[model samples]
Target: MSANDLPSLLSVALLARVGPARERLREALGQAGATLVLEEDPNTLELQVLRDAAPGAVLIALEPAIEDALERLDPVLGSPSLTLIFDEAELAARREGWEAQRWARHLVAKLHGHLDVLPPGSEQDGLLQPEPGLPTTPAQLHADAPLDFHVREAFDAAGDVPADGLYQAPDTLSEPMSLEEALAALQPPFSTPAAPSGPPPVPVSAPQTEPPRVPLGDHSSWSLVDDDAVAAVAPPPSATPSAAPPPSDFDIARLSLVDLEAERPADGAAAGAVLVLAGIGGPDALRRLLATLPAGLATPVLVHMRLDGGRYGNLVKQMARVSALPVLLAEAAEPVQAGNAYILPDDVGLAVRDRGLYFSADAQGVQVGTLPPSESAVVLLSGADAGQVDAVLALAGEGAWVAGQVGEGCYDPTAANAVVAAGMHAGEPPQLAQHIVERWGVSE
Candidate 1:
């Protein structure tokens, strides 16, 4: 099916010898707006899912009962479509980087209009070789699609941003507040009107007590209930302006690049960019994060998930349905483009080819190995790249922007320290998009 033809919601059933990989499955399916239902018995698992949603749904049964479940559901989920599976060694690998890379690769493949399952056994298991020359991989498929200049859509998907630090900025449209105005706003809600003559005297209604101050949360909304009262009693402007300098606490800028900002605008109107990073054990968090991306940003998202090659094809189809941006897997030898995302293969590292994204075998997996060029912008979902965190920092310092979700592996103090230092000194945090706009001078 075409990318746009995919469904919006999905329910997955996971069964294995051990407790189902609820967390992992949730993370992956969450990206596609799917809900994962965990159950103890495999037979009951099917009934539970059927009650909630139809079989056209995706069923992910790991290693143990995968084959049996697929065989049983083949006829039922086939017409509407169901993904039955067997074998799930990928989960046991413990190599987070490998899993994330696998996820990206699978996404690319599905986007390119191919959904072949990975056959077991062999020198190379999941990689597909198209007949003669129809670009088998997802990246290659991107080159074949249409290309158009997407304006502010950059922040929605496809690109990288600094994944650390508290970025802050001023809100451009906010007007500057004077000492009088500030004082007025801080007064109690049911206070008497101030005199309109000379500087209004401060109110005094206490024997020895001060009015409590109310704190505003991150987002605060207020309506001008007494505009007439405010306008009538408002003090007149000073006849002669004071010689003293302007107040140090005025808000004049159109946009604020505060450490707490969540999104950055694109540079000018060039192509829009978005950075996607997968996290381990909790796809729900990532999915929630992705869902909040503003609509109409046209941000092309390149995701880095830690999945197996076997599920890559299905993953892409799944992600496309839920993600704001169109999802496509990266092919063995394809070019990247706007309006489409390139998911990297398990064996490949995200890199830049002709200024677009490309994927290649990571000869040096995770730490110490040679990955795609350092300057390539990428969002690492999870893995053991602590040893190479410095290299990532160095590259980001040079020019590339990198964001990543720490994996389940034991935290590396050195890696955390290094990354924190880099973000504080060099990289930008994941949420502050406005700060990114100012620092990078991107306009969208």
Candidate 2:
């Protein structure tokens, strides 16, 4: 062991089966800034032994055999004073060299206190390459972006407001004047001419002149010009256009895919699955959820994330990189399937058929009726539309495992908040994923 393996400030209790795993974990705990107070197989460890040790933290080397070991050590495991750390024995046994050192550093950080555990300076994926040049700001750009035109125009269109500010009481305020006196101060059209305050003179009216009767002469006013020099650029009268060949007899779909029954949504009925809805800031939540989902998930995870410019294809590729299951674009008229994730586009809509759901173009948004209320689940993630909150709650009322992403890392929590307000489960992406797996009883 290196010098870093010296006893740490914190004391830790290790619970693992008596074997190479226990031996390795014993060494690892020492290297990970922890002093071992007790090391025993959880299956046989006495409750008194844990109480006597009373370590500040507990390290559990997890494996299939120790699935119920925590139950045996429930008293220690449930202690509020002790921090519990679990790591896969298989994965821990494989760690060596740099991997072992990195794990130790992370363990130390966790044992002590830190915000985020990460590489020293940057992401492990790759180094940050600085750009050679930065984008030039347009010279004509306004200091402040223009506001709504209606708001700007509303202030001055009627000329009600002055340049300086709102009008104030005039210093020379006058008493109320008579109606006629008020009218007399205005202009001729504005005022009523004061009704001519004298004897009525002979009513003089302007003469109505009859329109002149001018006889129309065809081509007389029109100029008759001699033909100027012209070149022969007209199409030849002898030229005849050739006819197009008839559509090939081999044509089967009648020149339109609509004629094919196989292409319609009803032909491929929906196979009910889990529906996950999100918008902005959803991709990261999706990554965590998909990453934690256990293998061999029977139901399909349909991700409906509305993106600008209909970038579903790009989304599918990005998700496929992180997702354990194959990511596919939800095509129109295709039935929802199992064992894979489908990225639903804006145009693709849902329809229920025989208690199942399928994608179609006739509608938009989640069709609550199409979803098997009892069988289907709805997970509202970050940036999900709040409009669907009622629908998800309705499903929840009908026995669906409706959930919302917790406030953490959620950019727009309107929808999730609504679901949570309605008393649905709210959790982080991984926690939600675990609930879903457990609900389906398909997780290992």
Candidate 3:
């Protein structure tokens, strides 16, 4: 629909599961000025209801059973006028105060296709009222007077001085006085005289005595003690130095560069996947890192990001706008491919099988520990889960090249900070991307 054709008040079709969140969603929509044309459980909603209502937007509160509901509503997913908003049930259920306000603002913006929405009572709609009996013209206002007249009126009212003069001395200092008279007035009233001088006294003397002299011997020779006698009187050494042991023959055989190379894994097997764990501020960080990477990168990258329910589609669309690599929602049984990014959905389990990545319908905890360190690497970016820090550290210990997002760009760096404290590499997105490219022999 054209931007100008958008309505100020939107009609919404809320297809949500029956729960407390649904009622809250209804109230929020109402607050946003949206008229509820149809409200029904997502599973029971039919395509005909949507067609008849002609709602400006569709709001779906995603729950665990959302996949089935989505499958049922597949036919209407392709509508051109459909502006779908997917809010997580947990977030909606707990909306209060600021959360409710935020949701309402977002809903109104999406309905009107605008980024800026004015709050209630802020629109420019009516004329402002003037003060009662306020003058409207120059003739009605009081005539301007000189500055001196106002000063005179103020002084006269305060009774501080005469209006005709600017300065007035205090009553005590009204008359003039000589400098000598002022100095005498400031002096003390009483004074004291000096005491009489005393008579001088006489001094006494004492006698001194001299020391007796001694005679010097004619011979200068003196007796010398033997060094051997002094050594005999001293204690003997406690222990004697032992002879050094012979070096083992095994220690002489040094491992050469060839031996070290032989112990290393094959290049193909060593070049493993790069897993990116992010949350909160992940989107912008992911965008920057992905844009810098060339399409020649051989390591398959898996992104496990936390997102609100039903936002995966929008996330993919948003990432594609800035990324050079292909950004797609991961599907089950898809083989791991180089130069492609797979975003993990909340519903599925991510696993590696037969040297290929695959998704499973069975829900499981994200098993980052299973990735072989010799062939795998991980980049902890922005809002990565704090619980994954220990697992990522263990992976690093197994020879994995682990890195993290650092500096001001990373909003939630709890996981990243932990990874850094464990002696792993940390930098901005572009720097991390460069490290990956250089380590894996990627083109850029």
Model 1 residue 326 lDDT?
Answer: 57
Which one wins on TM-score?
A: 3
Best by lDDT: 3
Q: What is the C-alpha lDDT profile of model 1 across 1-444, one tens digit per residue?
A: 344865444445444444434344444444434455543345444643554554334435344334454446444544435543322434533424555445533433332334432332433534665567554778876876655445446655645655455433324324587767656655557868876887856568645577689654322223465989777864475433335454597577776666864332232211324444443322332343344343333334445555533455555654444455456776644444444554555665544443444344564322212223332343443332454566666656666565544322212234434555556332222343333333333214
TM-score of each: 0.37, 0.41, 0.43
Candidate 1: list runs displaced more than 4 Å. Answer: 1-49, 52-279, 294-300, 308-310, 349-356, 359-384, 404-417, 424-444
In the range 1-444, model 2's lDDT, one tens digit per residue, is 334764445788888887776776776677865788888888888888998998988888766566555656676667657776666576567667676666676678768765345556753544667778765577546647676886879976767744764434344435686666555544244544567778867556845677899754333333444445222442365654455566676856666645533342444444567899987667768877887876567677889887656656656755665678889988776777667788887777787666556778754655654678767899999988888887778778888888899844576799998888888898999899999888775533
* CA lDDT of every candidate: 0.44, 0.72, 0.73
Kindly list the per-residue Cα lDDT of model 3 for residues 1-444, writing each as its tens digit. Answer: 444777676778898888889989998888888889989887877777767888777887866566566655756754656766766676578778875776688678878777555566666745777778855787546455457888979978897644775444334442378777666555558967866587644344433446578553322322365989757753366533445566667864675655434332222222357899887767768877887877768677778887755567656754665567788887765555667777877765556555545566546635777777887899999889898888889888889999888975576799999989888998999899988888876645
Which consecutive 10 residues in model 2 have the weakest lDDT in total? 226-235
Candidate 3 worst ten-residue window by lDDT:
262-271
lDDT of 1: 0.44
Task: List the candidate 3 regions with Cα displacement exceeding 4 Å.
Answer: 1-9, 117-334, 339-385, 393-444
Shift of residue 188 alpha carbon in model 3, Å: 57
